[model samples]
Target: MSRARRTLSATVTLALACTTLTGCFDESSPHDAVRDFLVGWQSEDYDLAAGRTDGERAAVRKALANAKLELDAASFRFKIKSVSIDGDESRADFSAEVDLGENNPLWVFDSVLPLHLVDGRWKVRWSPSVLHPQLKEGQRFAVDTKPTRRQPVVDRNGASLQRPQFLYVAGVIPSQLGDKDEEVVRRLSAITGFAQDRLLSRIRSSPPSKFVELATFGRTRYLAMKPKLDTISEITTQRQEQLFAPDAPMEIVGKVSALTPETEQKLGGPQRAGDSVGQSGLQQAYQDYLTGSTRTRVITLDLRTGKESALLQEWPGRENLSVKTTIDRAIQAAAESAVDQAEVSALVAVDRSNGEIRAVAAKGLDEEDDGLAGKYPAGTTFSIVASDALIKAGVKPTQRLACPAERTVGGARFAEAGQVGGPSPTFQENFAKGCVTALASLARRVDAAALAKSAKAFGIGQSWQLPLQSFSGSLPKLDSDADKAKAISGQTVQVSPLSMALVAAAVASGTWRPPVLVTEPSSPDPTAEIVPEPPPQPVALDPKVRTALTAMMRAGAVGTPAQTGSGRVYGVAAPAGDEGSRQAWFVGWQGDVAIAVLARNHDPAAVAGDFFATLHDPS
Candidate 1:
C-alpha cells in the first residue's frame, strides 16, 4: 500500500469515530441537565424535575407533595454561577432569591447541586436536603405561627379603658348532668335571666363531652344569680377580663369577640381558632396596630423518624402596642349618665380649641356606632348653618320676617309649633323660637348651594379620615324653594351627634377643625410608630358671621326673655307629632368645651342642660 493512501485512510477513520461518539451521546451536557432540573423545580413542575433524578424520583415527588410552606413560585429565581466536573461527577453552585411576603423578610441563599453518572449519563442525586439543608427523607415543610399578646386601649389620661371585671359565662356540660340536663337548664334560666328554650337547644345540639356556652352576664346580675346557679350541676361560670365601665360610653369603646370567618379572611394570614379580635368600633378600626405581630417559622418534619428541625426562615414575634386615644374619662362618664334614661340618644363633646373628641356616648341603640353614625334631621339645630348663610347673603339678624301659622311651598306645608303669627318677627327672634314657618318663608331669598357651602364651613357633610368609621353628616342637593326651606329649618338635612358637636366647636373656635381621636406615638419601631396624619386644613369663618351666630345661639338658649348666665344652653326642638317621633338637639359651648346632645322622643335641650349641669357639678 502507498504511504499517502494509508495516512489518508487512518485520518478518515479517526474523523468517523469522533463523529459516531458525538452522535451516540445526548447533546445536553451535565451542566445543562442540572440547570434544566433546577428550572423545572423552580417552576413547580415536579414531574419534569423528578424525571431527571435516578433512584430518588419517588422521594422528590413526595417532598413536593408534602410541601405546605407555600411561596410565590414566580418570585423564586436562581442563576448558576459555576459548574466544575471531574470525570463523570459534576457540582453546580448557584444563588437563589426567594420572596416570602410583604410581612416577611426576603430570603437569599447559595446552594450546590451534586450530579452523578449512571450508565454513562449524568443524573441529579435527589434528596429532601436539596430543597432545604434541614430537610430529610419523608420530611415535609410547614409554617408555624405564634401570636403576640393583645394590647390595651387607653384614654387621654393613659388609663386603661378596658378594666378587669367579672363576666359570668353560663354554659352546660352535657355529659356531667346526664338526665338532669333539662332540669338544670330550667333552673339556670330562672336564675340567669336567659331563655329556657335557647339553653335547652344549645344543650341538645352539643356533644356529650363538650360544654356549650349559653350567655354572659355582668357582675351585678351574676352576683344576684350565683346562689341558684351554684346549685346546678350542668352550669359553669368563667370570669374573663373585658372592656367594662359601669358609666363609660359603650358605643365608642366598642367590644371584642372571637374571630369571625370574614375577619379571618380579611386578616389573610395565620390565625388560630378561638382568637379574640375586635369586631366593631375603634377596636375593629385599629386592628392591625392593636393585634401586634405573629412569629412565623418554617420547619421540616421527618415523618419516619418523628423528628423536626427549623428551616432557614424565621420571623420573631413583635411586642403589643397600646392605642392611646383623646377621650376624656370624666366627660365620657357624664355623657353616659345623661343618656341612661333615654330610649334612644347620643351625646358628643369636643375640645373647641384643638378639635379633640372628648366624649362619645349612646344608649338604647343597636351595636353599630350610633354616636357618630346615627343620621337624624338636625331640626332647629341646623339653624346654625342657616343663620350663617342668611348673614352671608346680606340678611341681618334683626331683619323682620313674617312667622305665620302655616306656609306651603312646592306642595310641602311647614308650620310653627307653639306660637302663631300676630305680626312680623325679626330673624333672630324666630331663630330663638325655632319657627320653621319663618325660616321657610325666607327660603326663596337664599341660594341652596350657598346654604350647603355655608354648612360645609361648620364641618357638615365633609369627608373625614378618622381612625374609626364615622358618618360626618351628609347634605342632599336642594334645587327647589321647598327643599331649601326644609333645609333651612334643618328638616331635610341629616347630621350626626358628632357633626353637631363639631358645628358648635366651629362656632366657638371660629375655625372648623376635624376631630382627632388617636394620639400619635413616638416609637422608633416602624410597626409601633404611628404615622403622622396631616392635620385637617382649618376652614375659617367670617368674623361678622361668627359673631351673629354666637349671639343667636345664646338667645335661643335663654328663651324669649333672655336671661344672663355663665352657662348657656342653646338648641332647637321639633314637634313630637310632626315626624312620627319627637326629635330635639342642643349644641353649645361652655368655656373651651363644646357639646351636642341629641334625643329622640325626648327633650334634647333639657338633656343638654342636664349634661352641662353635671359637667359643672358631678354631684
Candidate 2:
C-alpha cells in the first residue's frame, strides 16, 4: 500500500483513549533516575543526568557555561508530570511554553521525549541543537537535549554519495508563551497538525534544559510538507557539505532503513535505531561497506542557573572507514540507460579475465522489486541445454537432423517454428534455425539425467553473487518423467535473463565461473573471499564436442548483418522464437570479449536489429 494512504488517526486514537482515563500520567515520573534526568535537564546539567560518566559531566558543564556558543538564548520552560521506564529505556511526559518577549505563547504536549540510562542515570536522547545568534541569548534557553547521528552512504567507486553534515530547524519564540499557551498550541498544531492537547502537553512537560526536538522526514507526507515550510512559523532545512566518487548504477545504494513494516516494528522503530539498513540497490547488498560508525559529543551546563557552566566539550563517536569496489561507472550508466525503456529485463556484465563485475541492472523492475530472485519460465532459449545434450549423445554439427512439425510426449505435443519443418537439415543448420522439434528429437536420444547435469554445469539455477543486489534465478530438479521431458524442452524450469547470460558466458570461456559483482583481489586466496572462480585451466568440454558447438554458434550468426558487425563477430549464435519470439538473443565471442544481448517485446527481426545496434554502439 502507498504510504500516503495510511491513516495515523488510528494510532493517535489508541494513544489518547489510553491516556485519558489515566489523568495525564504521561506527565508523571516513574523512577528516581527518570526524575534525576528531568532535574538535570531542567538545570541544564547534562553531567548530573549522565551520572558524571568520567568527563562527560565536565564537558557538558563546560558547554553550559558557554551557552552563547553552544545553545539558543531564548528560554522555553517545560512541565513534566510523569515518566515510564522499561529496562534501560524511558520516556518523559511534558508540555512546553516558549517566550521570546513578543507574539503569543507557544505551548505543546503529546510530544514523546526519549530518554536513556547513562552510567546509571537517565538522560535526554536524540535531541536537536538550535543554531547560532538565536543561541546568542545567554541564559535565555531553558531546555537541554542532545543531537542524533545520521548514517553515511557511498558508491561502488568509494565515492561519498551521501552524508550527514548539519541542518537548521528554526522558529521565533512566542511571548504570552505562558498565558496564551493554548493559542500558541493551535498555531503549532497548524504547522505540525498534531492534536492540540498533545502539542500543549509536550511544551508544558519538556525538560527545562531541552531546546528543540530533532525531527526527520518520517513518511512521504512529511517530505511533501517540506515545500510549505515558509508558511509555517517553524522552518527547517537539511544541507550536504561534501563530495565523493561517481556512482556505479542508476540509483543510490545506502538506504539501509528501507525495511518492511513487520521488520521495523520488530526492531523497536526509532527507539533503538538499528544501523542504517540496505533499503535498495547496492546499498542493500554491500550495506556493510556503506555503514560507518556513530559518535557522541558531551557538553557541560550549569545546574541551577540553566546556562552553560563551561566553555569546552568532548564527544564519543567512531571514525569513518573507506571501501573499494570494481564497477565501471561509464559502463554502468550505459547499461542502465539502455534498459530503462524496457518493462521487465535485467542486465549483468562481468570482466572475463578476472571475476570483477562491471555492471548489473534490471529493466521494468522498479527500484524496490525483490522478486527478481524468483523464477520465470525461459522460452526456446532453453534449447541450448538440449543441443548440448544432443552433442553429448554422439551427434555431430555436420550430421543431418530432421525438423518435424510436432513431437508428442506424455500426451502433450510440442511444435517447432522452423523455416522448413517437413525435411531434415544438418545439426548446425537446425541449431542456427532454432529447429526446436529437431533439437528435442535429438535430445531424446541422450539420458535426461545427463542433460540436467549439463545444464547445472552450465550454471543454470545457480545462485549469482553480485556485490550489489541480485536475483538468484532457479531451475527445479527433475524429479519425474514429466519433469525430465519438460526440462529438455525448457518448459518445466524458470530462469532469469541474468542466469541465461552467465550460461552464455560460461560456454564462451570454455568452462563455468560463477558471475560476480564485487572486485577481485590480486593474487587472492582462492578459498577465502566468496566469489566465482576463473574457468579451469583446461576446457571442461571434450575437444570434439566443444568444436561442434562452436561451429554451430558461428553458423547461427551467419547471413545476418545485424548479428555480424559487433566486436568483429568472430563467433555468433541467434536463438529465435523464444517467449513468443518476444525475446531475441545474440550470443558470441570476439577473442577475449564475449557478449550476450537479450531483447524483449519485439519480433525476431526487430530484436535482432536492436541487439546488434547495442553491440556496435556500446558507448
Candidate 3:
C-alpha cells in the first residue's frame, strides 16, 4: 500500500477491532486493570502501563503513588476477599485492615470500588466525573450521593420558614428490581406528586440502582396524594436507615433511622410543603438565622438480610438557629391593614422610654426599595432640627422674625412650602405653620456648621447600627451661608421613612436605639430581661420653643387640621381656617409610647367630615 493508504488502513483496522470487542470491553470493571497497571509501575515497567489510554494510565500511576506512600509510612493493606462480576460490572468487596506501624489504623481507610469492563477489560467510573481522579490506588474514598443545602428562611416570629420538602430516595441491590418496586414507586409518586409515568421511567431507566428524585416545596401536596397512590400495588419497602433530623413543624423530635418510605416521605414535607420558606416579608431578611445545621449518616447494608448496621462516618451540617424579632404579630397585621389603604404611607410605633421599635409598616412599598431604606426630602418635619439649631443660637420663638416668601443665601433664592407671595410671619407663627419662608430667614442667622451638627445629633446622616440593615439618612452640611440656606429649606438632605421614625424615636425616648428585626437579639436573648441603650446627650432647647413645637404638632393633629376639616381623634375640633392638608400626621407620646400616623392623599375637609360623622353615629 502507498503511505497514505497504509495510514488509512491502519486507522480502519483499529476502528474495526474496537467495534468488534465493544461488548467484551467493560468500562466498569477496571479494578484489575488498575491493579495490574499500578503493579507494573511499581515494578518500573513504565512503558507497559503507558500503553493504556492517558486517563486510565494516569489513574493507575496516581493510585500507585498513593499506595506506595501508605505502604512505606504505615502498615495498611486492602485485604481483597473476592472479586465477582455480575451483569456487566465488577464489584470488589474487600476489607481494609491496618497494622498501624507508626500511626493509627483510623488514619487509613477500607473501601469497595465498583468498576466497569471496557475494551475487554475493566475501568473505574465515578458517577460525578469530578470524583474519578480523586481515587488513589488502594486509597479508600466514598462517593458523594446526596443533595447539598439550599438557602433557608424563617419568619420574624422565629418560625422555620423554608426546608427540604422533597428527596431523591431509592433502595438498591445487586439483582432484579427490589420486590414491590413498582408499588413502592407508585405510592411514593402519589405522595410526592411525581407523575406515575416519570417514576416508572426512572425505575426502568436505571435497571438495578435506586432512583433519586430531588424533592421541592411541593411535598405537602404530594404527601396528601400518597395514600391514594399507595393503593395501586405492592412496592419495594427497604429498611432505610436515614440518620438526620426530619423537617418538623413547631416541634422538636428525636433522631430516628430505618424508617419506612411513607414515614420518610412525610418527614420530608415542610409545614405546608413549599410554604415554610419566606415567600415575602421578614422571612427573606433573616434567612441565615432560620436555616439550621444538618447531619448525615449513610449506613452500609448487609445485602442478604436487608440489614443496615455499619456506621458510616457522620458529616455535620450547620445548625439552623432560631431568630426572634421585635415585631408584634397582632400589631403588625393591624398596621399593615390600616396603611395599606393609601397609595403610600408608613407608621412607626416605639416605646418612648427606651426607643424599642414596636412596629413599622410600609404599605405597598419595599422596606429595601422605596420604603425605609430609600431617601426622600423630609418636608416640614425637618423643621425640628432647624428650630433646635436656631434656638441654641439664642433665637427664641417669641422673637419677632421677618418671614418672607423667599430668602437668598449665596445669591440663590429659596421658596417656602406654602407662601402667599407675601412677607412671612414671626418666628413662632412660621414654626407653627411649618412655613418655609420663616425657617429660611432663620437659616440666615445661624452658621451652617452648627445647624448640621444639631441635625446629626438628632439622627440625621447616621444609622443606629441595627443588626438588621438600615439606611443612614443623609444630612446637608451647612458650613457656609449657601449650605445653611439649603439646610433650612430641607433641600440638601436625603431622608428615609425609617430614618424619620428613628429621629422621632430619639426625640420621644431622649435616646436612639437601633432597629432590630431578628426575634432574638444577638445579645440579651428575648427570653431574658430587656435592657435599653444609654441616654443621649441632651440638646439644648428653650422650654418655651419645645412646648410651642409640641403644642403646634398637637394642633396640626387634632386641632389645626381638625378645624380645616381634619377631625379630632376625641371629637374636639380646633379654631377653623387651617389651609393645606399635606399628609395629616399625629406624632406624639401617650404615656411611654410614641406613635405616628401618616395618611396619604389627605384632605382635611374630608377627614374632618368623616371624623364628625363617626362621632355623631357613635360607631
Choose the strongest candidate by lDDT: 1
RMSD of 3: 14.5
Error of 2 at 210 (Å): 12
lDDT of 3 by residue, 194-311 (tens): 4454344333322133333322323344355446544544333222222123222111111222223343234332111111233223433333334332333323333344344344
Q: How big is the positional error of residue 322 in model 1, measured in Å on the Cα after superposition?
A: 2.7
- Across 308-393, the per-residue lDDT of candidate 1 in tens digits comes to 54555777855557778788988877777777657877788999988898988777763236677777778777888888888889
Candidate order (lDDT) = 1, 2, 3
Better of 2 and 3 by lDDT: 2
Q: Candidate 3 has what TM-score? A: 0.55
Q: State the displacement of the C-alpha of residue 282, model 3, in Å, after optimal TM-score superposition.
A: 3.8
- Model 1: lowest-lDDT 10 consecutive positions: 65-74
Please, what is the whole-model Cα lDDT of each candidate in the order they appear? 0.67, 0.47, 0.45
Could you tell me the lDDT of residue 102 within candidate 2?
A: 11
Candidate 2, residues 1-619: lDDT per residue as tens digits?
Answer: 1112122432343345334423533333334444444344444555664452223556445544333223322233445556678987776666544222111123232355566666655555532232111123232333232322333443356554454323223222322153665665676556555445434433433333343332223345345656565555433344323222224353434343422334333432121112334555555554333443333222343435544543322333233334345556555555566455555544555454443455555555432242224344555556665567677777777777687777765554667755542476887787776665665565456776777677777667555544444453445675554455566656665665455555555556666566544442221222246655453232265556666766766666666542545443423333433335455554444444344444466233333334335544765
What range of 10 consecutive residues in model 3 has the weakest lDDT sum? Answer: 570-579
Worst 10 residues of 2 by lDDT: 98-107
